[model samples]
Target: MTTMIKTVDVTTALSDVDRFCDIPNARISGEIFHRQDIYEQELEKVFARCWLFVAHESQFKKAGDYIATTMGEDDVIVVRQKDGSHRAFINACPHRGNKVCFSESGNARGFICNYHGWSFDIAGNLIGQHESGIYENSHFDASKWGLREVALIDSYKGLLFANFDADAPSLKEYLGPMAWYFDALFDNQEGGTEFVGGCIRSTMDCNWKIAAENFVGDILHAGWTHDSAARAMLGGAVAKVSDFDESYSVNWHGHGYEFAMDTVGNVAVLGESALNKYLHTIKPSVAERLGDFRSNMIGSVSSATIFPNFSFLPGQNTIRVWQPRGPNKIELYTWVLVNKSAPEEIKEKWRKGAMMTFSPTGVFEMDDGENWEYCTKTARGKVTAKQDLYVGLGQESLLQETDLPANVYSGQLNEANSRAFYQFWSDLLKAPSWNDVPNRNVGRVEAGAAAERCSLKEAK
Candidate 1:
């Protein structure tokens, strides 16, 4: 017999958004991370309504190529058609609920359900049925039986995303000022960036937010947490890189940046000479494409989260999609990114760099995984679940109506990003539409002035 799990009343729990929002210096309520009811609520409020990253354009190159992916745990097949447009549909058969396409990815003219031979074209049109005679007078319409389509789908610099809610804002609008940083990476060159190959998949017993928060806000962990790995590679001079002595920027949509020293601790593996050579080689190209400001960012270490579940570490060149398996479990998919126009040798070096630092087997990823697991386990205890967690490190330093182009956080080690993330989370949970997100913190047009002053001071 199938077991039935209890459903959580997220609407009722969300009524206390202010309670969760008020405690900036403590852990969020432990119950929020592990409650079954809250997880279901997230499926509706967070997953269903938000734009979710699905696949890279590079994955579907051919006219009939397709890839099976997911958006908030719902299976979807992204297809490239002869008309040069892309489309996505729920991978379930219309006749029955069986998954129509099972392969992870490949070229295909159409999908034929293994269950009953029901087929759909590249555009998700019901083109063929095994038995049309039986349904001739049964009031069956092929058009009506097509695979269910996602309400919204779009691409930005080759990254494809979808949303189930029709009323959500355009993907570009949703990305907000964070696009400036992405332009530094994705649109740095003429052809833009592309996924080098398939992604690395892994699972962990921890709250998905823990992993997301680490990627978005935890710049403090690199030095001490990965100290052993950094020391082994650097011959014990990891402090030059991992020390959090830099500025922070928290964007309006909860996307944020931690700008720290260029000497990432992991680069110790490449040695100073090799590391210097690598930087020298990429510097001119980066400057030519993105100008001096972004070129300077090339060496800085960063951890960025795009709202709910998408995150990318541009310094490490790793793109991650976090799929929530439960309140306390997450399935992670990671991809390595490379400039499409980069030299083969440079691409290879970047790949090696990524594999050594960010993959499932990478030293830093393992360190992060351990902490996430421990945090989740502790939060699940009865006493712990009742208490609130803290995140108010830079609350006082938040420049609410600043002249910066982005929401600037004061310190590298501050929790401003985490706080912004939870703020958006609570807002999303309560608001009925994405349009309801307040435009209270849009940044000024002249953002880099303060950053430029700091750069000059450092030079002096």
Candidate 2:
């Protein structure tokens, strides 16, 4: 039996998401980018169920250190406790729904609500309130009035993530094979990675998915869209995509990455010679530890998105999350990441270099913002919203003769990753519960295992 879920759309009234997605044909409707009702459903079905990036362990060195961030539109405060464990809670006060914390981050003994003076301990337990004698006659119990705690929280390689859905899989399980690729960037260094400075936030008049899907695998846009910026920084355009013999666009489940074998192409875009030289000096040791496959990727021309909205540029070392502000707008939060073992000078170079190319006011960022904003703004028309946008550029280019995990397409210019991303998006939107959502990568993983076993037997 097939379960058909109807999703709301501005153009078609109520319709199945499959009609809009059209995975086999590689087409999708524009209404998915600008519909208010669809965006509301995504909040409940996608944002609330995913393992969203919240904060990094480097941000909290001692008890009570905390940073206030968002998972979807719901404001949350992730705090370190006395026991050295981390926890997160809703940023709103239990009394009258007032915001408790105003600062972005700080070390505090407790959070006090300005509206009614209700106070909560670092662990989210209600400890005090204004005029205790006044509440003595009421049914208010301090023990039961604590701030609502986030359902689940976990970490991977110093990055902390929180989940609102208790029924969702553990973070490790949720990451699945994507963890294999992440280990190269995050865990390859001896001392691991850390954020360099306070986050820089900016707003864009575009849907979050437009920004996300770009990072996911739209390498085709780089050569044309950012050509001027690339020429300014690197003294030439980004790598030519028509000759993609050594490049791939790979997707695992919903996560996607596109990269080329030009080991220093992305680093060169930062226009910092010291940083580029630094990567070369460390490549041999990385190869010894994680093997050539991941080691060669250390300073490669690559970009990735971890489903829904988090994205990063590997060699440029810019990490960001696109928090959906509304159906047609997003708030982008960005940070520069560097290896903790790096020298002070090298880390400083990384901070400035990344900002020069990817920050809100950077040359590359300016080009992207205009493109995505127009992509969202023009989709608002009734006739324009009904048209299907073509995403089927390289449907016939699937590559299987490789050890790469997940779905690997042969060229950097392919839309395979974008197609895989939308398929997963539709799957999430149409499923009633997590149980109904399918793991689309299972067969690819199994087939890879089978191929590996065959080669091993032949070697004997």
Q: Which 10 successive residues of model 2 have the least lDDT summed?
A: 1-10
What is the model-wide C-alpha lDDT for candidate 2?
0.83
Alpha carbon lDDT of each predicted model? 0.73, 0.83
Alpha-carbon RMSD, each predicted model: 5.2, 5.1
Error of model 2, residue 164, in angstroms: 0.4
Question: For residues 12-49, what per-residue lDDT tens digits would candidate 1 score against the true structure?
Answer: 33666666555445447777778777787788788887
TM-score of 1: 0.89
- Best candidate, TM-score-wise? 2
The residue pairs in collision within model 2 are none
| lDDT at 179, model 1 | 67
Cα lDDT of candidate 1 equals: 0.73
**TM-score of model 2 (CA atoms):** 0.93
* Candidate 1 deviant stretches above 4 angstroms: 1-13, 21-27, 240-246, 261-276, 399-403, 440-460
